[model samples]
Each structure stands twice: as C-alpha cells, then as structure tokens.
Target: MVQNPERRTVLADAAIEVLARDGARGLTFRAVDREAGVPAGTASNYFANRNALLTQAAERIHVRLRPDDATIAAMARSRPAPSPEVLERELTAMYHRLAVQQIDYLALLELRLEAIRRPEIRAALTATMRANLEQNVAAHRESGLPGSDVDVVLMYLALSWLIIENLTLPGVLEGYDADRLIAALTDLVAGR
Candidate 1:
C-alpha cells in the first residue's frame, strides 16, 4: 500500500486538469500521461482505465472541502448557534470564486454528465452530493435552525445547480454579473 505519494498526487492533479480543460469527452490515459509528464504506461499501470483515473480525481476533490469530517461531526453535535450572516458571506464569496474560475465546476459538471452513462461514476457523484447535503443540514442545525429546516438544504442545492445551469445555458448569464447571483444565493441562505 506504500507508494510514492508525490507521484500519486501528480497523477490526480493532472487528471483533474485534463478533466477541466478537455471535459469528460477528452479525458484519456494518454492525455493524463502527458499532463502529468509520466509515461503512458505509468498512467495505465496506476489507473487501469479512464473511469479509475476519473474516480481517483474526484476523490481527491472530495478530500478538500471546507467542512471535513471533524467539522461535520461538530456541527451535527454542537448546540452553539452560529450567525448565518457569516456563513452567508462565506458561501457567497465561495460561489463567486467558483463562477469566476469555473474549472472545478466545469470538471464536476462534465463528470456528472458522464455519470449518467456509467454506474460507477453515478455512484460516486451521488455519494458526494449526499455528503454535501448532509453537511449543509448539519451546519444549519448547529446554527440554531430547527431540524425541520430541510428546505434550507434544498434551497442551497437548488441555488448551486442554478448557478451552474445559468453558466451552461447559452447567453443566459452573459449580461449578468456573478456578484448578483452570489448575492441572491447569500440572501436565500439567510432566509431573506
């Protein structure tokens, strides 16, 4: 189980870059090999297949979210209330960053579509989405919001999809600025 962590990180980073730049349609073993500056055989040896490589890349992403396991557990158990204003501000800033830099979202969206055709990808995507929803619900509960606030998580998820959908739709958000959407999401989260 012990291997060069650096090499594995490189492979994962390269795979993410390839997925972002080329979409799922262009993710290939050869492309990842080139991006990572590793031999094609090396990628094949590590990944075994395109799906394996993509799954690993997605796992790498899942490791880096703001509320990790510790945070999620604390939120689930803590009774202390947090100000939604701060969370709203943080969430808005994050969404703004994602929309402006769009690589991660594009990669995620591409993978999501690919998942529709692949069971493994679908499972991974479903798990990730569920985890995020659960995390958001935990945060809301910790912030003194009642457990009946399921709509908070639903709104959060819907607004996220709306941001991506607006970007994906032809000419829909061309005239609109990202800050506006970020503000709207913030307001939604704050129950304004």
Candidate 2:
C-alpha cells in the first residue's frame, strides 16, 4: 500500500532480519521499523498487515538470494562442456557463493517454517521457488552443463538439504568439506 517503492523494500528487508533473528512471533511493525532505522510507525504505514509483511518478506528474500546475471554468465562460461570436472567446479562455485550469504539463507529457512500455517506465504514461496527452479534447470540444460534434468532435480534436493544442514546444524557434517560433498554429487550425476 505504500507508494514509496524503495522505502517499502527497505521495510521488507528489515522484516526479513527481524523474522530471522526474532522468529515469527517477534516479527512486528515496531521490530521492522527499528531494524530499518526508520520512524517507529514506518513499517505499519508500508504494510497493510502482518500477513502482507510476511509475504513481502518472502518476495524480498527471493530477490536478495538471486545471483546476478553476470555471475550466472561467468559460471556458464567456467565449464564450456559437459563433464564431471565441469559439474564439480560449477557446483562448488555455487555452494561457495551461497555460503557467503549466511544471513539471507537463514532468513529463507525461517520463512519456510512460517509458511507452514500461512496460506499466503506458502503460495508466494511456492510460486517464486517453482519459477526459480525451472529457470535454473533450463539454464543448466541449455548451458550444456553436466547432468540430466533428473540429475538437476536430485541435486537441487541434495543441495537444498545441504544448505539447511550447514546453516541449522553445522556439527552434523563436521570435518567434512562442503565443496567435496558437492563434488560427490557431481560424480553421481555426471557419470564420473
């Protein structure tokens, strides 16, 4: 409802930080406003309700987590042909990049938990996640990257769980190098 797109985006991002740090129950207009360093009523004016705030937060997470096109293109060129080594490098690079955004990824995980009971959140996440997945699969396929569509799907599941495990329960994979783990996936999919 807020006409200032930049301010609204700022509030939504603040809501993400609040949600991740404070959990669903702690996500309030005041919290978001405080996080954004805006006026106390700023978030309330920007969002229609808590649900709207939640949905916008989800959307904002999608935007924040997206890799820029230049990065994608560089990755595409990193491995000009389909091979196990190519797949390994690509996956390893992707994992490294995502690992750097620890906070944003954790925020996404929090949003997933909140989505369970909120239909609006579930719907928004589903739509954007589906689109993102499809786009990724297409990119992988078109880039002549290693792995079949089925492999892409499987790796997607594995990588997502890997991220979750690394973020939420780091000790579970203690002593194991994340890049090597991703390389194992490349092996399985690329027929090495």
Candidate 3:
C-alpha cells in the first residue's frame, strides 16, 4: 500500500471537526465530505464508513495526548517520582482537563457512546484506553511506590472514572467546587 500523507491528514482533520460539531450521531460520510470539502465519494473511500472514521479519529486523539516513550523515560529519570499523593493530584488534574475542555472531552464521549453499540469500535477504544492506563501505571511503578501492583492500577482506573462520572452527575456543578475537588483528591492520593 502507498502512503498519501496529505490525504490522510485531510481525512483525520475532517473527522475531528465533524466529531466536535456533531458528536457521534452526526458523523457520517457525507457530513465529513461537506466539512472537509472533499467529494462525498472520496471521504467514503478513505473511511469506508462512520465506525472506521471514528476509530481513526479516536486513535488520533490518543496519539496526541499519549506521552512518547522518550518523554516517559525523561520523566522517569528527572521527576521525583510520584507518590500516591502525586498520583492522585495528577489524575485529578487530568479529569478536570477532560471534563472542562469542551472539544477533547466531547470527542471522547462520542467515541465511548458509539463504542457501546459497535463491537469493533468498542474493542478499539478499549485497547487505546488500556494503552493509556498502562502508561500511567508504568509511571506510577517507576515512582518507587506500589504502583506496579494490579490493585494499584485498578484503583487508579476506578478513581479516574469516578472523576468523570461525578462531573457528569446531576447537581455536581452546583454543589462541587472544582478546586476543592482537586485538593481533596490530593489528600486522598496521599492516603490521608
């Protein structure tokens, strides 16, 4: 197979814009075509269908946010390494960023919602999310904590989702202060 960087770039960019504006339900071949200014047929040619497009778009997002191996190594070397306290703080920030950042969070939500109905998309999302979790687990492990344990990794994952869930829960915005949440998480991670 030949690589057409420009075409792939166009498709990927178009996919993100479409997802951002329309969510999963609004993403379709023709919609992307219009958004990307490409022929409908051409957009379809590249993506084959909506699922393929979403999977690629989600992967793109993952790639953009995931720390490169070299960066991870540098972090391992220079950083004081995370204690449970630091881990909690870092995760809380990540949760806040994802929830408050409209485009990124919305796109991720779209991928997740669609993944429920599409097995292929679901698998792709699971794999991508797993990779992200593993990276975090590795960092935690390197920090001289008990992070390498399956239990620690599982706990972090559960806590991360709780952050997301609480943000979306009813009355959370009215009752919860974001800064307080972050501070509380810091203490929680410290095992206070």
Q: How far does residue 63 in candidate 3 sit from its true spot (Å)?
A: 1.9
Of 1 and 3, the candidate ranking higher by TM-score: 1
Residue-by-residue lDDT tens digits, candidate 1, 3-101: 677887788778778888998878887898899998776677777688877777766655543445675575457534555555555556556544554
Worst ten-residue run, lDDT, model 1?
A: 75-84
Query: lDDT per residue, candidate 2, 100-136, as tens digits?
Result: 7777887888889888989999998888888878987
Give the alpha-carbon lDDT of every model: 0.69, 0.85, 0.68
Please identify which of the two predictions, 1 or 3, would achieve the higher lDDT against the true structure.
Answer: 1
RMSD of every prediction? 4.4, 1.4, 3.5
Clashes of each: 0, 0, 0
Q: In lDDT terms, how accurate is model 2? A: 0.85
- Model 2: which ten-residue window has the lowest total lDDT? 72-81
Question: After superposing candidate 1, which stretches have Cα over 4 Å from the reference?
Answer: 64-84, 145-149, 174-178, 181-191
Query: What lDDT does candidate 3 reach at residue 153?
Result: 68
Per-residue lDDT tens digits of candidate 3, residues 1-192? 225667866776677777877887788878877887976677777766677788878777776555567966764576555566556655565566555545655577778888889988888888988888786677566566534457556555655555556545636556766556655655644555
